[model samples]
Target: MNLKNLKGDVLELGTHKGGSTILFAKYLQNINDPRKIYAVDWFKGLPYSDEFGNTDEKKKAKGRLNDTSKEFVESKFKQFNVDDKIIVVDGLFEETLYEKLNDKVFSFVFIDCDLYKSAKFALEYIDNHLEKDGIVFLHDYSNFLNRPKYDWGIIKATDEYVREHKVQFTENPIAHFQKITSI
Candidate 1:
């Protein structure tokens, strides 16, 4: 995956402090190519943590209302060294994604919405918005922990949908699902 010619739109379904977004954007910056990257989230906070686990509804609420400001998340990205190659789109997945971004075709999409409903929406949007042969990186493909996990909200929903749809899936140990499909 050289990604030198993968200069197309990118989407981030969830961006907590912009961790993985920085990874993608940092790579883009290193290559210095023209691409549009989007981070879709309210950025309030996560619904669950290592301490809270997935059972806590408050974690979900925090994820729903996580404190968000593009500048704030972007700043984090800058701290990680990828400022020039990222874009921030603040809003919910279903409500705002298609409204603002339906026209574009993405090359790579990362889904980390951390809620069942939102993750479903993110996967649906990526399925609709991505080009044929595009790649989708989904965080959390079915990791069982004795403690709660907030990210299951979207991942499990997406996992179920993907299985039902019979899309091809490849899992990475870092907890990402690589989906190769035509949208």
Candidate 2:
């Protein structure tokens, strides 16, 4: 995604505790742009429960999101001094994205939702609202390969959609985007 200053909107899905959002806020502040930066998450913890392997870690993560995430995200946004410019949507993308992105186009979107459904939802939004030449950076592709069967499913889905739609992709897009734009 385009990591440069004060351009179009940027959204991050699955922000664990707003760290990456904070970084984006700072960059936008540096460039003096009033465009919105959004952080969307359910904040209800991971989708699966104890059935998956490594139950303890998932439980602990759920406890943090369930218990302390709101205060932590608010505090961090203040600390970063971009609180007003950041839009926090505290729900699943299925619940919030179309409303949030209504009539708006984005320059950058990061998808880190890990789960197949959320990832697919994020990709759908990117497909519809992302500006021409916009970039979508997806995290956890390695997990998709090495973790579970469904992990690979979203990868195939995204690849198929991109190919069928004829989307352009560049490696290291966050950096390369500054020097380029779409046809």
Candidate 3:
């Protein structure tokens, strides 16, 4: 994907440990694109539950994947030498997304929130802010790896969004949506 051709900035809805954020920063840096990558996350593990009644037993039983902090992610960015290319936004999607990004436009949105409600909110925000020809990369839209069983809300929410909005979608190993018009 040639991100240079895309317009506006980048928004990453989930930044666990900053792996994907670093990858985006490195790519933007290599292309000499000056657009900023906004990395949004709670830095805590998954929430207890969402509005759609989606829950993870592992999260309930063991508090899964909560070992990361915003400072830790920042350190990773600095270590990767792409600190200047990324901004870390700390908070839940419902609490901080609109407030922080209302004035910004995005040509690329990476959604890895992993829950129905989180993914739904992220997609709702993108519906208005994403620029024409923009791309939405949704993680866990398919059970490609046959990984441990988890909530399939991402799939349900995404499919519902696509059907309701009549948006253009590509059903690859990793499903994605291309915004062709502004709603």
Candidate 4:
């Protein structure tokens, strides 16, 4: 999407410890945009299964990224003085997305959820809710292309979504899709 044309609210799918969320907040601050940032994440960490054949039951049980708490993330936002412009939703996307935010619309969505199914769901959901000319920045997409050490789930999900919907997309800094017309 055109940076000059960015409007309406922003969304983040995976807010791990609020690092990227902080940057998004700062970007909004620099632009003087008053729209709120809806940061969604499973602060309890991530879950894993045998679907990919590299199941880590122990890690899933212990909760990866569980070291960070929602309160800590909130504090980081407060420290940046962007807390007032954010709404933190702490839950699994599948359970919390439509249930808690079915009524909301977004001009920009940042997808960082590092899994196939989760990323797929986020893309589809954003496709339905994103306004015309809205943009989506998909993190972890390059892993399938340049990062050989990483898994391909995010890339697989993204490729499938774009192909199935016939959405135009770009990659590099991230996978960006600007909604211009129905395909």
Best by TM-score: 3
Clashing pairs in 2: none
Write model 4 residue lDDT over 63-180, tens digit each, in one string: 5667777899999999999898899998888888899988887888899876776787888788778877788888866644566534536667877887877466887656788887
1-183 per-residue lDDT for model 1 (tens digits) = 434445458888888778778888877777765776788776666533322226665344554535666678877877876666777877656567889888878878887766666666677776677765566777766444543333455656765776876355665443444445555
Worst 10 residues of 2 by lDDT: 171-180
**Cα displacement (Å) at residue 151, model 2:** 5.7
- Residue 1 lDDT (model 4): 39
Q: TM-scores across all candidates? A: 0.75, 0.71, 0.87, 0.86
Regions more than 4 Å wrong, model 3: 1-3, 50-63, 143-151
lDDT-wise, the better of 1 and 4 is 4
Q: What digit string (tens of lDDT, one per residue) describes model 3 on residues 77-136?
A: 999999999989999889888898888889989998777777888888888888888889
Q: What lDDT does candidate 1 reach at residue 9?
A: 84
Question: Whole-model Cα lDDT per candidate?
Answer: 0.66, 0.64, 0.81, 0.77
Best by lDDT: 3
Clashes of 1: 15
Q: Each model's RMSD to truth, in Å?
A: 4.3, 5.5, 2.7, 3.0
**What residue pairs are clashing in model 3?**
none
lDDT of 2 by residue, 1-183 (tens): 334532568888888788788887888788787778888887776553322223355323333445436567878899878798788888778888997666767787877665545566677777667766677776644344245423323454455555566566443312111213342
Residue range with the least summed lDDT across 10 consecutive positions in model 3: 53-62
User: Which should have the higher TM-score, number 2 or number 3?
Assistant: 3
Residue 56, model 3: lDDT of: 48
